[model samples]
Target chain A: MTERPDQSPLTSPRSERVRKAAALTGRSARRKQGRFRVEGPQAVRSLLTHRADLALEVFLTVRARADHPELASLAAEAGAPLREVDEQILRAMVRDSGDGGGDQGGADASPGAAVGGALVSPQGAIALATFSAEDPAAALGAVRALPADGPVTVVVLHEVRDPGNVGTMIRTADAAGADLVLLTRTSADPYSPKAVRASVGSLFHLPVLTGAEIDALLPALAAADVTAAATSGYADSDLFDTALPARLAWILGNEAHGLDEATLAAAPLTVRIPLAGHAESLNVHTAATVCLFETLRRRRLEA
Target chain B: MTERPDQSPLTSPRSERVRKAAALTGRSARRKQGRFRVEGPQAVRSLLTHRADLALEVFLTVRARADHPELASLAAEAGAPLREVDEQILRAMVRDSGDGGGDQGGADASPGAAVGGALVSPQGAIALATFSAEDPAAALGAVRALPADGPVTVVVLHEVRDPGNVGTMIRTADAAGADLVLLTRTSADPYSPKAVRASVGSLFHLPVLTGAEIDALLPALAAADVTAAATSGYADSDLFDTALPARLAWILGNEAHGLDEATLAAAPLTVRIPLAGHAESLNVHTAATVCLFETLRRRRLEA
Candidate 1:
């Protein structure tokens, strides 16, 4: 974990390498480079811990390096190059990632700066990693092949537009022991900096397959013998009362217009999380957390 | 609901009133003016529906006015002024609010702006309203006075620094039929633009008391006969197995650091939301949703 004795720290924010790293913040740039940027100590730690193989490089401020001594060894063990930079360079790279530096009201324009409100709180560590591009069909098939003795749970995001919601749901899905997370074609790119930051490295913990179609996915679930259920505010089926199958796919929809009529109708069952207060609906991510936790709770009870 | 044909629409974005409205985005300006700005159709709709008396003025673009005709009548009925403006003017006001304009990748710098990356998706409608500055003690007393036969639920945010999380928890608490939502002194301002927007009008739907001290709050809950439960990942008590009381408060801590030792020690109960997957901990807001909903579910089950 010790710093290399021979090399000087990367100092220039405008260096070609720095600019290239900053470019990964964009979707097309990430697509072309075949990698995404992950920021903050927690996320970087998760990267080094779970998906070290995908880590291309790791960058840290002197302060961050001191704060997290083990990250260096983790990076070294993964064969990912570890570079130490000044705080300015780290901030420059994070700022350029387009993760919401603009909204820190003038007063918070400094220390209180919560980039993107709260989702992107950069804590002086960043990494670039390649997320494997998995074919949705093959991904579903792989999960289906898991031993039949254990339950197979999947969460399908259908055209969800918000990256934070998408990422938060991914984290929740991961926490709930879901086997895989699949996003439809129109959903937010899980590789987006906001989504990755929000995921807090869970993006590395599970297989996240994007660019899927519900049309193909529903049939795939059927073939895999996984029951599919859509979440809707208007649905009559209550989540608590419904007995879920051993292999289940929980389908969540867009933030604004929920699941389209066809998608909702296509699902074998529709369930609503009962709202006891005045809120018209739960945030998509919050609802997903409840649903995932409920599934876990039920499964544990049954066991 | 008809727009006054006699009066011309407010057209200048640089006008004093527009600038003053923009200033409310700052904490000091909001405190000084005794008002906070609420943006978008959903929040504005909630303001008009629930706290109409607190609304001073409503601003809408031509399209917004046309899209929501009921707002005009609602504002008029409340004796609040409604002013029409152009989309440029509305955008200018929103942009100046300092809600995450900088992080939108250059391409999304326009339509895809996602000001503050989804937390602040400013639509054309905006409202200036007064949130009653209730003393934390008085607010707790009021909730404690609610019918004794019915369960009283309260959510306490202890030094939670994220505005979006603060707002989202408030919304979830409201949705879970919580009697009150309280925040400690170091917590994010619930009136912050990002928080208000993330709350999606639930701030108007419920009473949100800020600047509370956990020291006083814990004792207050004890006096009020409401059980206080601090959420901790390390706690031995599983949230699912614990039987809650008729009146309860779910205490949540900061995002990076969980509850402090003093606060944790003072709470009557410490409960952990079981994580079935690899996520180290739930986002503070996500955890609150699980806690609040679980409470609601159990109460309903008992009924």
Candidate 2:
């Protein structure tokens, strides 16, 4: 992962390496090159700390280096090359990063504009990580081998399209102490820049296996002895009143069209977050957070 | 406020009224005209239903009127003139709408791009409404007049800059049965296009008063006999363990800078949501939802 350290900072946004890094914003380039970019200091810091083995390179403006002095040593310890670049390079890197195919950004779209305005200013740091796509079968096998001392919670996103929502759910799942996140193939790419930015580095916190099929995942959960729980607006059981299983997989549906009827019927439990007011439903991220935290709260009370 | 009925559909994106409607996307124009634009069907529907008195005009494409037949009667009942428009006009209105001063949108920025990708395809409907600014004092007085309810919950956002976050908080506050949401002067405008879109029409479901000062609001809350509780990352009291007051105000801080020391010290109560995982903190909306719902959960249990 180490590159030849040239003392002079990389200043050109049009440089070959910068262009290649920027291209990773699109899905095809990331898929073809087997690497994805993590923007912002928080995400880069997490990459250097947790998944250093996957860290390919770390780029930062001189000011960012001054702001966070420890990043240099962190990158050194992680065996990833640390390069200094100007703000323009950082801006150019995030500028054209598509919104994970939601809307096409204009050719002249400003820096960080492609991320749904999730990030306004450059955090002055970005890093590249080799995409190690986790297989659901292998991930489930890992979860199955865990000790049975307490309940294990898995968050499954089924065909959720928004990268920001996907990233936020990953962060919230981690915050709720969930074990793993499994995403069906139609779900947003967790490794996208928008997702990584929104995750605030939680993508590296736990095993997030994408490319799942609900049909295959349901049987896989059964094999692992994990109970499947789906959230539906019309569900009979209220989330607050229902007693969730010890080993649970909480399935969330798409943003526009929720879980299909067959999948909803297949789940062992379907619960709704009771709305006390006139809102038709909660945002997907909010619902997921409420659901995951409720599970955590229950476990805490049980303890 | 009704425009003359015209049988011909609005075809030009460059018409005078269209330009004026598009200008409401900016703060100065909205302030000058005393009107804000609400985009998408959900928000427009809520506006016509709850605050129809404020509805100035409704614009819809030919397909939108057909798709949502009820909108015509709703507009008729509201006495707001409904005008048919083309997709281009709908697109034109949303395009170049600034991102509430967060960042400048380019001249060629696509439709709905200004909203942080909150809305992708136009919902084929948009409405202009008189900006009715709610007074915090009067709103608090209304809350005071309510019967000794189970619990009166008010969500306060202090200098939070994100329009989407503000909108989501409003929606979540309504969902949790909160009485009102007050925003400090430095916070994003709840009537902004991004906010109205993100609120999913919940803005019409409850009273949201902006332009508050913490110093004044603290005294007002106290005088109203509402306990002001501020959420802090370092607070000692866990949200679950704390016994809240019958009348409560949940004060949330800015995304980057949290509640200032003075504000935190002045609050009657301070509590933290116990994060079970490694996240530094929950997203503002997620935190607000958890805090508000916990209050509701406690009240439900008591009932």
The model with the greatest lDDT is 2
lDDT of 2 by residue, B1-303 (tens): 334434565778887767777776666667777888888787889999998988988988889999998888999999988988788888888765444333222321345553432346568998888865646565555546645645688898997877778888899999898988888878877887767877899999987787777787888778778899988878899888899898899999877678889999999899988887777888777788888888888878877
What DockQ class does candidate 1 belong to? acceptable
TM-score of each: 0.88, 0.92
Name the best candidate (by DockQ). 2
**Interface RMSD for each candidate model?**
6.0, 3.3
Q: Give the TM-score of candidate 1.
A: 0.88
Give the proportion of true interface contacts each model preserves, from 0 to 1.
0.52, 0.41
Task: Please provide, for model 1 over A7-105, each residue's C-alpha lDDT reduced to its tens digit, 9 standing for 90 to 100.
Answer: 455779877567666765666667667777888898999999998888888898878999999999999999888988877777666545444333221
DockQ of 1: 0.40
